[model samples]
Target: MLHSRFCCQWGNTLSSTLLRFPLADHKKVFAIALPMILSNIAAPMLGLVDTAIIGHLPDAIYLSAVAIGAMVVSFIFLLAVFLRMATTGYIAQSFGANDRAAQRQHFNHGLLLAVLLGSAIGLGSPWIIDFAMWIVQPDTQLIPLASDYIGIRLWSAPAALITLITLGVLLGRQQSGRAMWLAIITNGVNVVMDVILILGLGMNVKGAAWASFSADYVTAAVGLYWCARALNWSPTSIHIKFNALRQYASVNGNIFIRSLVLQLCMATMTGYAARYGSTVVAVNAVLMQFLMLISLGLDGIAYAVEALTGAAKGQRNPHKVAYWCRLTLLWSCIFAIAYTLLFWLFGPAIIGLITDIPEVITTAAQYLPWIVLLPLIGHWSYWFDGVFIGLSLSKGMRNTMILAAAFGFLPLWWLGLPLQNHGLWMALSGFLLMRGVFQALWLRLRWRQII
Candidate 1:
């Protein structure tokens, strides 16, 4: 009886300790982050599979064409990702306010914008392809293959945009599992079709494009059905306001510019890497894949913070926002540390699996230390991005990105010219670090005002 009483007391003490330390907050954050993390990690595989299949072809030009084509499309698509970001912010706030009508209205506005814009992109495919090719200045041999890939992929623009909107809604509503399932189904189909069309039917890059188009539509269908059920909406009940449209344009426009600048920074980096020779380019590419993988995983947590913090702000609960932010930063730090360790210990083996080129492998392994450092140095900016987006403070986000690219990255790259590839990696790391620092300063100054 005495031992039982002592055990009960200890249990009470432990529970109280956990409550005070915000263990429950961690649980809430993870509940939303884990699925999104899985989805984000899987999303990249679609591109990787495309690259892998094309890389195995006898000619290197096929691989180059696919890479260039996909990069161009991805740049355009990523710029429009403001659709997802703005939608998430608006819907999450509405959800927090418990305003179902506003939620549905925002959904309608977002969907309409996506459809109109996507249709515009598809209709203007020829001009876009020409413009992209002119900017890239690809070899004569690659132009046709790249053109074919871009043309077919453009057909999926509408579906891709629709999927983006649905995902934003699902995430804003904290329906992470549903969102994840949609990604899995979509990417899964793309992978299967990649094999069939690329290998079995000998469609090559065209096959890959067709596979993405089909998978996108499939995902959009599933997303639309799921969104309808989740929102429990009738066609008649949905409303679109001109004022809401203007607001969306305002928010998304800023985000669009921000994303555009970001793409330019990345493109410039790649262009410079190319000047160092094909071996350096391949090595950098593999390193970038590592960085992207880490970022996607971290983005999962950032996304959760976006939803939770946006909701907290909508409800005018500063304490809740602070709580979520602290927990998210803590979790992000934990993840960064784990990633650092993983890359440090196993990066060479991972690089080998990515490619068999001995020169690329040797060069990449030499730079493995930088990859190990990336997660730690770069994660804070990602976390800040979530915080800014959640609070609908997009102007700061845009400004910081511009500043980071213009001042932080460019200057460092210029100064580090003597270091070659090492200099490039340094500049990239500096960009991320400066972005986090500047944004943090902005947040600090505006914290009370935002709340």
Candidate 2:
């Protein structure tokens, strides 16, 4: 109905931008998305490398500790992901409006927030790890090992958070090629470190933590250098505008709550997995790497949609927004289908690739069907997330996630308790589906301005 109305109201005339030159729009999508896909792909590859190296250890407990530790460290990043999302949305709008001053404001504010937050994380690393330990409550043996891994990894929080903002600015500006290279720099260094520190040095879990810690600084340095080169950026020039700070808090707060709820579900998953047993925890971890791999790869399209829709929203062009949405939706479905098929066909082999543990591979493959179904359930939400972010609409994003978690996931998780791990997967699947449904409905309700 939204598509129909947009066509009737502003048809053909909008073609000059997308309709007239469909291939150009296609080219634009891939230009932004391809690099993003490569960049996103490298991230999960790093995770796979981490899992693979840790899995080769003689005991499964090391794998469990690192997995749990990685989740905490990465969840911190996820919680702080508000920095990148808000910056990308705001900067994309500024880019669309050709408002250089606003662009600078968004970038500087994001940079400042990153530094402050990153520093806070660095100072609070011990407390954060301690809190995660309390909440997740892994087996007694895993507590110390997970703590060591989380502690070492959190040392680089400042750099990691800063890099997050940098990537957001790059993606928002549509300098996706540079963003891709930045990802390559961060993740490539991580992969090499995994090989050297984890594999060669045999530092076990500590090696993985150190690998992630070192990569953050490398990434932050390169990211800052690029910022300096492109924008003549410097900390000394940053002006602390009270109004801008207020705006950042207002917008970013909702985004933060939204991320918090999302991570809560993730944390719950890990927590529940721990209760299921150490084997289940490792299985969940192994499986999650693939889930993230699917989502991040699909996020290429979502990020493209965010940028384009943001630009469109800035320009007040309903037709452009609608056109880009349609294009993104097509690609989202295609990517989802491809991921489903790929996982369905290669799930066991891939699990085997991550861990040599016979039991982990076999038990993990039992739940491979859920992984096969996740891309289909989850991709649309990723698409709508782009739409909301592009339009600077965080409240909708927050509301949908809460409803999905509270109404869709929690109840389902409770009722299916008897099914054990499969029940957890069922609840998780419902969560993603509910999010997509809620987001789609919200988009429809907001169609006029969105289109």
Candidate 3:
């Protein structure tokens, strides 16, 4: 009889434990991730379109022009990505704490920083362009075309950064759906303008850059309106508060370090790739799209984890935070496996679809198989970035990234050089592996602190 009673109590405990899972919250999490995934996907659709449109142009000139133009712009705008990351963490935490005032304050802080940074970028465009040109050392023929594209596109830096701030603020508030809507609007307009200017008006590279600029400005305007309405901006609240600025500065300072290191790593990789001949650079450009596809897809789940974990931490619920970390890893593995399978089976056909250049197509295809390995190895840092960001451990994030970039990326790349074209692929793969391994190890040791 005692044995039977013990068994009954044990079964009851097990059942209650199973029942404690947060199904509704899990569903809500997926709801946020779905739109976020679409937005993430749409974000890269522009790059794919640019490649397709410019690839079929009269020559490689237009394609290379787009590549250089877009890369320079990406390097510039990605600095503002911290706004989104910091905002998401801060806002999610405030949401968890049920602090509406804090949310409002964080949003305003983000806007102030955005304006300050955006204005600075606008004012420095001329020197920035010249510096970028000097570093990349474009061929004589392509320099004029690239310059034209950069000149017009840099004019939109303020709008682009403003959009970054808006997206960051919205993501912080857990308004993933709204962010998706805004991204779709921006991308859709950009695509239509590209078709009109490049295809309809026969404007070539200039049209492509202008289309992007116009789309950014339009999106910025709409975003400004949405943010103002959401924040209940009245005469009393129009000016940002000093205390809010202090908090924002503290959070963003750490994140800025994190963002800067990531940017440097990316810029370093692409810069090294450019040191090779144009054929290799073109091939790397093609491969990067696939890499972006995988990373961005995985990033959806990571972003979800960031929002959920940040909120959980803010609420002082270690159990919930732990649950989210486990769930994120599980989902990440599933997506990783699915992407690997897709790339392995269809990589050649996908590469063929991007460019008609026989050389570019062949080179990209040869390197495509290596990409399958990325989903397995590359998904970890993408996920862990969100994990640390959620826990507000941005300083650790900054340090880890810098270490990985310096120790892992630079040395391996330097050693892999004898292989030439193949070495670039090997080096990039090593960089991704190092990021995953280092971040995973760090997280393993400090899981308690993070949770």
**Tens digits of per-residue lDDT for model 2, 1-451:** 9999889766554454354447878889889999988877776667677578789989999899988998788878878888889888988888888887777778788877888888888889889988999988899999999999988888788888788788877887788999899888877888889899977998888888898889999999998777666665677767779898888877888999998998888777767877889999999989988877786668889899989998887787888888888888888887898899989898888898889998888899889999999999988888889888888888899999999999878998998789989989999999999999998888788887544
Deviating ranges (above 4 Å) for candidate 2: 1-21, 46-68, 136-149, 191-211, 274-286, 343-369, 449-451
Q: How do the residues 1-451 of candidate 3 rate in per-residue lDDT, one tens digit apiece?
A: 9999999998898566545656775576677678888888886676577568768778889989878988888777877687778888887788788887777777777777877887777778788878888988989898889988888888887788778877866766677898898888888888889889998999999999999999999998888788778766533675678986887777777778777876666666677777787988999888887887786678788888888888888898999888888877777877898899989998887788778899999878777778988789888888888888777777677778877878776787788888775766676777778887888888888877766
**Model 3 lDDT on a 0 to 1 scale:** 0.80
Candidate with better lDDT, 1 vs 2 = 1
Range of the 10 consecutive residues with the lowest summed lDDT in candidate 3:
230-239
Question: Model 2: which ten-residue window has the lowest total lDDT?
Answer: 12-21
| Comparison by lDDT, 1 against 3, better one | 1
- Identify the candidate with maximal TM-score: 1
TM-score of every model versus the real structure: 0.90, 0.83, 0.83
lDDT of 1 by residue, 334-439 (tens): 7898899999999998999899999899999888988999899999988998888888888998898998998889999999889988888988899999899889
Give one clash count per candidate, in the order shown. 0, 1, 0
Clashes in candidate 2: how many? 1
RMSD of 1: 5.0
